[model samples]
Target: MGGNGKHRWKISFHRPSSSSSSSKMEANHHNHHKQQEEPPKDFLCPIYGALMADPVVVSSGQTFERLSVQLCRNLGFSPKLDDGSIPDFSAIIPNKAIKSAILHWCDSSGVVHPRVPDPATVEKLVRALMAEEEVYPSPPPFSSPQLRVSERELIRGVAENPPVTFSHAATELGPRVNHFYSSSSEESVVITADNPGTPLPFATRPLCYSSSSSSEITESETLASSIPNSAPASEEEDHLVRNLKSVDVVDQEEGVLSLRKLTRTREELRVLLCTARVLLALKPLISSRYAVVQTNAIASLVNLSLEKPNKVTIVRSGFVPYLIDVLKSGSIEAQEHVAGAIFSLALEDDNKMAIGVLGALPPLMHALVRSESERTRHDSALALYHLTLVQSNRAKLVKLNAVPTLLALAQTGSSASRVLLVLCNLAACPEGRSAMLDGNAVECLVGMLRRNELDSEATRENCVAALFALSHGSMRFRGLAREARAVEVLREIEERGSERAREKAKRMLQMMRGRDDGEDEEGDWEKALRSGGAGGVGRNLHGPNSTTF
Candidate 1:
């Protein structure tokens, strides 16, 4: 009976058969396939259609692969995903939580972790998608009937009525005379020479013709002739348009030169000549291999962009990419004009964001630091100053490591005043503050203040303001300021500097002294700046003469 009991216990504790173990392994394999076949949808990027190695959230609040977002931004393409939604690539934030979730899912599901996609392969995919988009453009979204009718009417009105016209004689001159009206007067008087029976049309004369005995006229005839034997503005513009669209480089050069001359001083002509057809014709010449054509084309764009309305119109017409391209690779002369055009366009509040979005920051930064031309550096600095007024652009510049370059320039007094202005704007944002602190901006700025090396009271004031802006919630600033002996500089500014500088200096001193005033918090400082307090950078950027291009 005892032996039987032991046998029963042994049987109860025996190991499983080989077939049973094999069946358990098969079950696990099946579960692995099930998980691989249906991973979480959010783990995949809409643009890449694969697991995202590094996911980020864009301004549109959608997650995508960071490389994919960067490619779209650089190419200036906004992709439509399978869900028919378009992503805004203006701003990006890392989706750390989602990234963690994706990695965890991969580990648990026995799926291999995703790796960063190859840049060349990703670029090829993006270009192919862009080609498809070009071939088959997306349809417009639905709108109310009333809104649609209003839009149609607005477009038709713009199409039917040109911004400029010419006198009747000028219009009649047509292609016969290449001359154009030099005056804004609309009246055209045709005088019949002394005889009424055989009427003689007013003779058309070239702009540079000299008066001779045969051509001498009476006072009344001279007045009538002063009406100008010229072609309509539209006809002249069309002639330039044709030249710009010509295959020959000579014709293109002539067109761009004429455009530059015509739009240089006449505000009305600048507004009129900035039409879509004229811009389209002028676009290709901006990238021409011939130096004359490219320089004149960029200069013409600068002249045309002088008008207020033309600023936004030029950007909307797609001239920004060409301008940015010139900034990168054009001749030094052309780069100067390109910088001028960018500065002119950035003067408009509406254009600041678009210019930054279409990849203008990096090249502008390059021109600011590396260009040998003084005007190019000046305008490039001013353009950056204006561009960084927007928060998104400030963030982008910080990411580009602009603080160190700016600080270096400031230390050397190379465009120090303008460079400090950009720093002030950057200091308005949190990322800029952190970067500035990391770059030892406090010591650099304090050194300037201590030595009185800045250019003017305004520059000195801006340096103080930047320090004050950086002082918000920054413990590192206190220690750095102490080490740089900033307290003595602040004391001097508080005594003899401008009113704005004195005020900012006093506040920074208060913060450095470890005053527990409620105003020391970051939010309070931001609110104070936004509410037009002493250290406000964004709202006070546009000075009385700041818009000069």
Candidate 2:
């Protein structure tokens, strides 16, 4: 071996360490388990997941939900959850990447929600929630579903998000929760408040003229029972007793009159509507025919929300169409309800689209114009914010020349949520932010700012951010802003923008002051929108119109 002045050698070893490999394998398995697990089911957007753990609600959508109820009624889907429910999301998701919003709720608690999947899809979720595997129960295809009445009603309630009443309130109650009523089955007994002693209209009068000792009937009994207990009286005493009994009879009549007044003060139309709503919620259990009756009854409530004392109930029923009419009608109450409904349906894409189609944007802006609360105006703006969630709907809104309204809302609307959603849509729309601005939206926004007395902190803040968004996403829109004197507005925006938005304000300042030399930011407005802003600011916009229910 040493002959060539070098030694040849080979080395070999057993397999690598099993413990190290096993530990790595275990770690991998743990990771795999984690991957398989679902994200903790949440009911709020990631932004407010911590603050609004129970649910985020608003009351500014009154105007948006009334007419849309018709659209929603036909939207024809199951209602296991709010629009945020992943609807057949296995393959297609409705852009959860934007907010990761979920409108999940236990209906037993009666929480109106937004952006939930349509009823058809929610049925699956309800079935799954109930731990029921789909059982294609069939004698063959096209057979009658031997569904129990309760099961059918249950499905109707869960899938369609229809009203329902429980046997003993299986559903729980919450601060924001409200219960529905069924009209047909509820016993509408008319109690006499004026007179407790007098016989009811349904009761009979006793015939005993004289019962020297028993003429005074102490206990309640049918007139028939009292007749049997009466004793025969002598002639002289009978006449004298008759006079005494007459006084008692007159007293009884007075008591009855007083009782009648106290009992059913009166069933006003509003109370009737409220009663109908409650009864309607009881659903098919009350009567098979009632389901059909309730639809009309509930639709009437939209006309009633603006009334005193009963308007509070509208907060409970931010349901579609009923409330949308009010929103579209341009009533202050409608705007409030629309805002509330927006929060209710914020988690739903269909709801947003439906409310939008119901002409919510216009009224929303009007509401913001005379808003009493900063939050109310913000919610009104948010209604518009919610409307643009659907891409096609947003496009339709653009075609309607709605950008001006939304821009106005953002500029003079919510300080915090000023451009939160409108911008998202403008960015999402086929119309680039620049295109939106070209439609005179920048002028409209700047106009809002110009009209302001500059007293409202929220309003000023909102205006600045809205301008920033206009210029931020689309160079064309930004240039248009400059033309509209939006640069001047930007100074105001700079004065009001959040700490995070200051750099943007500075950049706009440079651009507006004509300091940025040659870079063209307008050519690709769409790209700018895609980067951060969807396009411009999104906020609730209330309309000036008012419709009394």
Candidate 3:
């Protein structure tokens, strides 16, 4: 027994033939053939109504009573008998031993957990369990529906961190009092997270946060640091939601989602809500003032990335730091989700600096130090590319020691585009360009591209364009680009990108390979003139009216 006399009983499912089980059997056939084995026609327990391959296994007489209690409870009986005692499930045991044996063989106790049912079996089970005689009203009106809205709020707010006060907008919230737990607590409400995994004062009724996907705390933090006592919980949830933008992404269609159901696995709900939140937040339609609020709000979702659920649907949650930390927790799902999140984030710049701040680079770089996946290696480098775009961020990138790791990434097959971008951006900066040009990066890029290992056509173009970025604008990269097959790769890109990814790659390639043939091509004199303004780089990028980058 684990908790509350709950015994772990594996109910073997008997079927005419279960394909999943057959497949499993077929997979294990090699081992089975080597040994003498017969079909698993197991034993039956007449008392508890169970089947087993071995009679040595103990019969679960008490288990039936417990299960009956649970089923009766679910079926709207308090399972406390009409006499105010626990039901005597001995009510189910009056049959002769032979009759009991037959019942045991029938529906008494074999369950393939997580298995959905055949329509016939489902219909039969429903019909049997729901005979007209078993029909009951909703528990005799249950004391005027005594469960009030404030009590619900008290339950959830206390559950939020436990010991919740009445002031979390306690005025007549109704069932929506669960909003904070739903929206604010981002951890997927899976069984493990919502259960007694984290130490809270109350163990019988779940309270406080779930076991998070991040570093394991010796103890959970004080709730005061997390939820605010004074926030008008329900009002805040509705007011800010109207402004988010919607992009027509090619994903699962809407209306297929069942977000309203209460039992759809807590983490799944978390993932769905999180995806909804982020997909909306990214577009300009969202109010800028709510950016930080939304960002903090979604950070709570970080815990679900470690659940090993297919994060692909909710991948847009932009939980880079959370996922990265999850990977650090030594969870396989964490590593995969972190990989997925990094790959997803590099597709845009919205959360780049925040990702850099989330302490991703050090762990990512550490993983990349020896990883062989070109995909993983490439995404890691790509994330660094976005992180380096901000000047303040450049220091952290350097601190993650990504330059050397990025240089190594260029040597891998999948990293050509990322390598070119990183090298180009680095060269565009005074120190970064100096580091690449004066060192081994030039030869490394050339070697990587020429090896035929860099399969991505975009990488080929980026390599060429990076040569131009290195060679043209700054004297430092200009010297390095010429040394790194910049001319050859540029020609390749001009030919391929036109028929390939269109003008974006081609225009960039052309810009890097520009000569003094046109006014635009002659950027130096214009750039020098542009530098006379106070904004310098800022003006050169965005005009005088442009907000600070």
Candidate 4:
């Protein structure tokens, strides 16, 4: 059992047979005839129990049908092995050798095999499952009121061992809380209510309040009044809201934690990435007044957004503005969560500019400038790093005074690598490089190299690239690079760094000595001038912005 006693049952789905499977079977039958021998179990698909076609191997060293594994993934479940461990779909490799072996067996046996359903039909079934039309509720007040067998068993267990308050137990049961009935104009006054019984497992007596009207006392107030409390009306409402919100917060937290833990399991993470329940539930709660609730919700969204499928889901939900609002007014912890969520979503190439268009930079700059938490500062810079990857986003970020802020962070903050990457991106533009030079970024670059606080080759590569840009700007800049003992560092990098780094270092060294290394540096310098500026040369240099999640 996991959080809230909710067990994540594996989704059961049958694989669709494809034309490929059928053709292979038919081809085997048309071959040589001989006495049939039993096919090895390894040659059979674990799900369909048939001769394997397009077999694939997983990390667990077990092979299964490709279509079957894909079907299981589409069903939001992992292929469960006999040992009960579910392997991630990405870890599964196509086993062409096993497939060939199965083909040989089928040809030698000359036995007729059943025609499997077309692979296209199987794919359609998978798409339907992925769309979740039949599994989960589409709208509120689900038509199918009956629960799953597992859910019903859990509910019956609760009914048999009833809680002290039937209302509390009813609340505990995971039923959709529809406001439809409560919001209706119809008012049915109960004369008297029955006690706990067989059919109605538990009953509740309405709170004895004077009959004013539904307008005077809201449903939540009525619920609060039913509980034994001696506070004034205002206090009662607050108490009720706090209790309700607390309960909601707990449920949301459990769901968030479940998603978090599910990410550790490859197959479970795939399902979580595709499932919309957590995203839908958390989106509405980002505006929650409670800091803890908003933080947990944003944290969950951040985790989900790390996956490609979930990243699009989050961005499409129109959450960037909401997240920006949280950054504006949320607590430090909430701001950190919001920043992480933003960057995770921005990983998608399409979302890079959308985040900038939504005005995410202001709050991000705010966090970068004033946040007391180093982690918050780092996260803000990281988010800005991804957002600035696009040309338009880079302009927006620099226009918002992001360059100076990032430079300041690089100088004294713990986010040296994050700030360095963003600086690297901005350095590709003329105005960005000028801003770096004006912000004394060369000194910070030198200090970073000297201090070696962050032992990352990527960071050093970025620093060298920035210095190279500044060194080419003017004689004074070249003098500054030399004063920072850049020559020694460049020599070491030219000797010890990667091939690209060595090439860049050699150019920088030749430039410092008032000599042209060759036509290569001349073309590069002209290209940098024409293209605005240069980025880090090493492949691993300044890879995607660092993220805490």
**Which is the leading candidate under lDDT?**
1
lDDT of 1 by residue, 88-112 (tens): 5656678777799988987776567
**In candidate 1, which residue ranges exceed 4 Å CA deviation?**
1-232, 516-549
Error of 2 at 140 (Å): 21
Top candidate when judged by TM-score against the true structure: 1
The root-mean-square deviation over C-alpha atoms between each candidate and the true structure, in angstroms, is 20.6, 23.7, 24.2, 21.4
Query: Judged by lDDT relative to the true structure, which candidate is superior, 3 or 4?
Result: 4
User: How many backbone clashes can be found in candidate 4?
Assistant: 5
* Overall local distance difference test of candidate 4: 0.54
Of the two candidates 2 and 4, the one with more favorable lDDT, higher being better, is: 4
Q: Over the stretch 1-549, how does candidate 3's per-residue lDDT look in tens digits?
A: 111122223344444443454577686884464233222222322122244222221111112222333344334432211111122221222223333443454453333222222335323332343352343324332311112233234335434653212322212101211111212132112122322232111011011122232332211122212334344244333323322221211111111111111112243333334333333233221121222322222223322222333232233222343355444543332243345445344333434444554456677666455444433454455455555665545666554456676776666534445455655566555566556655567666656556656555445544544443444445444445566655565455455542322332344345545533444533642342123110111121111111000
Candidate 3: clashing pairs of residues: 42-53, 43-52, 158-162, 186-300, 189-266, 427-433, 470-477, 470-478, 471-478
Task: List candidate 3 stretches off by more than 4 Å.
Answer: 1-322, 342-350, 371-379, 448-453, 477-549
lDDT of 4 at 160: 71
Query: In candidate 4, what are the lDDT values of residues 1-549, reduced to their tens digit?
Result: 011112232222233344544577676763332213556767766555556657776433356677766665544443333433333343456676677787776666554442443577555543443343234322322211222223334445545764232222112112222121211111122221221110110001000100223344333334434544332345533332233223344544444443333332232243334433234344556887655556656765665565565655566445677788888888876776677677657666667765776677888888877876555665677677667777877777777777777877666666565577677778766677777777777777777766766445545555666666565545566777877787787788789865445667888888888886444664685464333222222222112221222
Query: Global lDDT of each model?
Result: 0.66, 0.37, 0.36, 0.54
lDDT of 3 at 29: 82
C-alpha lDDT of candidate 1 relative to the true structure: 0.66
Better of 1 and 3 by TM-score: 1
User: Candidate 2's residue-wise lDDT over 205-275, tens digit each?
Assistant: 00000011233332321221323223312342233223222223232222222211211112243233343
TM-score of each candidate? 0.58, 0.36, 0.36, 0.47
- Evaluated against the true structure, the overall lDDT of model 3 is 0.36
Which residue pairs clash within candidate 4?
Answer: 17-117, 17-118, 17-119, 18-118, 18-119
